[model samples]
Target: MFATATRNFVDEVDRGGLLIPVRSLNDSIALLTVVVSQKGFWFWQKPKHVPTDFTLNDILTGDIPITPVLSETDFIKYNGIYGDSIQGSMDATFIHSNMNAAGKDSSKLELSFGSLKKDEVDVRQLLRDTKNSVLDMSHSLIKQTQKKRQVFGLVKERIVTSQPCSVTEEVQQADQCGGTLGFCGPKSPKVSLKDNGSLSKDSNVTMEIPTNTTIAYALIDLEVKHDGHYELCLMSNKGGFEVDSRTQKGLLGVTGAVSNNPDDVSRLAQELKDLSDHFQLLSALPASSKASLLKIVTDVTEDRAALGALQSVLNRMLVEKSANIADVSEAHKQSIQPVLEMLKESECGSVAETECSASLLSALHLITSALDELTHESLSALRACRSPAVLKITQLLVHCLCESGESPASATNVGVLSEDVLANLEHLFTSSDVNLQRDGDAATIQIKQLQKPGNRPLIMFIALRGLHSLAQGV
Candidate 1:
C-alpha cells in the first residue's frame, strides 16, 4: 500500500509542484505531474451529483471550473479539526485548512512552490531521522547510573546494594505451572523491557515503580566509544529487581511492550501525520472520524494495521526525500553570484575571527548543531534529507550569517571545551574540576565560564575550540 500509493500519486503528478488531495489518509498530500497522457476528469460537486459535462479525468486533472471544486464541493467546508474526504477534487476553497492565518487562503499550488522550499533537507530528513533514532537508542542503551542504595536490613547491617529497576508500561503472566507471572522470585529477579526509544537517554530519566513492581530486571549496559565501537555488558546486580509485573505472570513472566513511548505504535500515527505522511489524509476528515482513525493507527501493536501504518510513514518519507533531492539539484547557485565571489577572496577572515567572532560564532555553532541534528538519525526526517547538498546548504546558511559581514545580535554560545582550557588555557579550565573538589567549591564552574568582554566587544569569544576538541572523533 505504501509503495503503490506513491507510485500512483507520482504517475498523476509526473513532475509538478502541486499537491493533490487523497481520501486515503488524514491530511495527506499527493502530487499530480503534468503527464504525457491527458484525459477528461471525473469529479462530483454535490452529493450523488456529477458536473453537467464533467468526466472523471477532468476532476482528477484539475481541469474543472474552480467554482465546483472550491465552493460547491463539501471538501471546502471550513469546519475545524476534521471532516470526511470531499469528492475526489481538493475543495479549492480549502486547499490547506491546516495552515495558519497567513497560509489559510493559500492554495496547494502556493504550498508546493512557496517559501517552504528551504525546509526541504536534500539528504532526506527521513534518513536522518532513522540515524538519529539509532543514536538515541545507543545513548539510551548506555548504562544508567545505578547508585548503591543504603538500607539497614534484618539479615544484613547497612546493606549497600546496586538497586536494579526497569521502566515498563505493562506486564503479563506465564501460562505454565509453578510460575508467577508479574512478580519474580529471588532466583529470577531481573526484568526485561522493550527499548522505549526515549529510554536510551540520561539513564537518570527514570520512572517510579508505577503500579507493577513484582518482577526483576536483567541489567545491561551499553557503552559507545568515540570511534563508534559499542560494547554491551550484562550483569546480575546485588539488589533485587524493582518492576511492575501486574499484567503478566509466570517464571518467564510475560510482559507487554515496555517502551519507545514517542514512537509507540499508538503514538506513531499522530507523528506520521505531523510529518505529512499518509496520515495527512485524516486532515480532510471530520474531527470525530479523524480521531477514530488515529485511534486505529495507534492501537496497533500486533496487527496488520500497525505494519501498514509503519510502512506508510516510511514510504512517504522516502518519496518526500527523493522530491527534496530534485529540488536542491535544481536550485540556482548563480542567484547569489556576488556573495560567492566574496568567499573566493584571497585572504578571508582569520579562523578565530570568522569562527569565534561575536557575530559569526553563533551561526557557526547553530549550523554545527543543525548538522549534528541532521546526522544524528535518518529516521528523524527521511523525507527531508535526500542529498548531501541539502546538508551543505544548511551549512552554507549557517556560515552565510558570517559571510554577510553583519553579525546576528543573538549567537549560539556553546561554552569552551575543558580540554582546550587544559591545553591552551589550562588552569582556567580544570582549576575548578581538580581544585574545586579539593577545596570543596563545587560551584566553581558557575563562577568562571566562557564570558565575552564588553570593552573590547570584538574580543568577546567563547572557548568553542574546547567544545570542538571534546567533540572531536566523538
Candidate 2:
C-alpha cells in the first residue's frame, strides 16, 4: 500500500506538506525520492568555471546574468524546521527501554545488533546516554545559531513609571528615563483626580516599583501651593522678534535703486509713508506697545508727528538750497526733493491729512534751526518743546533715511558709524526709553553723550547716514 501510494505521490502531493520535492528532482521522469531531515542543505554542486570578480554595476545593468541555485519553493522547503517520525521513533524506543529496565539492574541488561555480541550495550544505560547526547547537541546548535538582531529608528522600549518619589529621588529616576521630566519640588506630588481636588495631608508616600504606566503620564511634577486650579505658563525674558525676509529684500532692492537713480528715492519714501498710513490704527492700540520692537516699527512705520516734522525739514533743505545736511551729498539732496514734494502734497492736498499745515509750518522753523546749526543751544531749544514728540519724530526720520539708503555717511567712509553711536542708535527702536541700554552700557561716556536731551537725534542721524552708505555697498 505504501509503495502504490508513493508512485502517484507526485500528482496527488500538497505543496504545503512535509513531502515537498526539491527543484532538481521535481519534474524528472525517473522516480527520484530525496528525504531531507535537516533544517537546511548545502549547495553540493560547484560552478564548472568560476567567473572573474565584477562590480555591482555590472549586475544592475544586466551585463552579468544571475542564475539562482535554488527556487523559492525549494529554498523554503530546505531551510524549514519541520518535525518528522524519526525523533518520535527514537523517543518511543527510549521509553520502551526505560519501562523494561524498571525494578531491575539496568546495567546488567544488554542489547545486541545483527547477532553480534561485540556491538551490544546495556539497554537502559544506552537509552539514557542517547537522550542526554541528543539534548546537549540541540542546546549547542541553538546557542551557536542565536544572534542579537539590530533594528533602525526610534524603537527603544520605554517603561513609564508613576512611582511616588521625593525631589531628590526624582533626579536619579529622571536620569534613568533619559531626563524626560520637568522641575520638581521638595514634597512628593499629590495625584489630583479632578481640576480642583483637595490636597493630601499625609506626608508618608508608599515607595515601590510601578508595574504599569502608559505614555500619557505627566512630565511635570506639579505641587499646587493654594490652588483652585493651578495655571501653568511658560515665560521668556527675551522679546519675540521676527523679520520678514521678503519685505527686507524688497527694501534692500529699493535702496540699491535709490542710490543709482535719485527718482527711485521717492518710491522708497512712498513705501515708508504708505506703511505708516496703513498701520496707524493697529499700532496705536495698547497691545501694540507691548509687541516686539521690530514688529512695532514694521507695523507702525512713523507716527503722524514724525512724518509732518520730516516733511517740513525736507522742504526747508530744498528751498534753502543747502549744499548738504551733515554728510548728505548733492545727489542725496536731489533725491530728497521729490520725497519732500510728495510729503507736501500729502500734508495739504488729501482729505486723509490730519496734521494741519499751520502746525507743520510751526514745527518746521524749530527743526530748520536745529539742522542749520547743530549747536547744543539750538537743539536744546527744540528739545524743550514736545521733547517726547521730538525724539519720536527724529527716530522715524532716521529710520526713513536708513530705509531709503540716504542716511548720513561717516568721515571714515568704510563703516556706518562709531561703535558707541551705533549702539546708542539701536536703543531708539528697540527700547521703550531711547536712553536705556539693553547691554547695561548706559553709564559709559559715549552713551551718556548720545543720551543727552538734545544730542539724541544728531548722533542717531549720524548713525543713520552711515547705515545708508553701508547698505548700498551691501
**lDDT by candidate, in order shown:** 0.20, 0.23
Q: What are the C-alpha RMSDs, in order, of all predicted structures?
A: 32.7, 41.5
Which residue pairs come into collision in candidate 2?
A: 407-465, 408-465
Provide the lowest-lDDT 10-residue window in model 1. 151-160
The per-residue C-alpha lDDT of model 2 at residue 391 equals: 34
Tens digit of lDDT per residue, candidate 2, span 1-474? 111112122213332122321111112211111111111000111001111122112212223332212111111111111111100000011111211110100001011111100111233332243231111112222222111110001101111223321110110000011111121111223221232222221122222322221111001111111111111111211111112254542110000011121123344344434434323332232221112211211111112223223433444443443323454435444333433443344324343454533333333332332232222222212212111222333444445443644343321121223243333234342321133222322221112322222223332343222222211211
The digit string of per-residue lDDT tens for model 1 on 1-474 reads 122222233323332222221212221111110111111111100001001122112322223321111111111111111111111101111121121111001001000111111011122322232232211212211112111111000000000112332221121111111111121112223232222111211111223321111111011222322223323222311221122257742212111112222212223223222323211222332333222222222222112223233323222223232211122112222111211222222122343433222222222222122222111111112112212222222222223223332223232221222222112222322321111111121111112222311111110111122122221221
Worst 10 residues of 2 by lDDT: 83-92
Residue-pair clashes, model 2: 2
Compared to the true structure, candidate 2 yields what TM-score?
0.16
Off by over 4 Å in 1: 2-8, 17-21, 25-474
TM-score, cand. 1 vs. native: 0.14
Query: Candidate 1: lDDT over CA atoms?
Result: 0.20
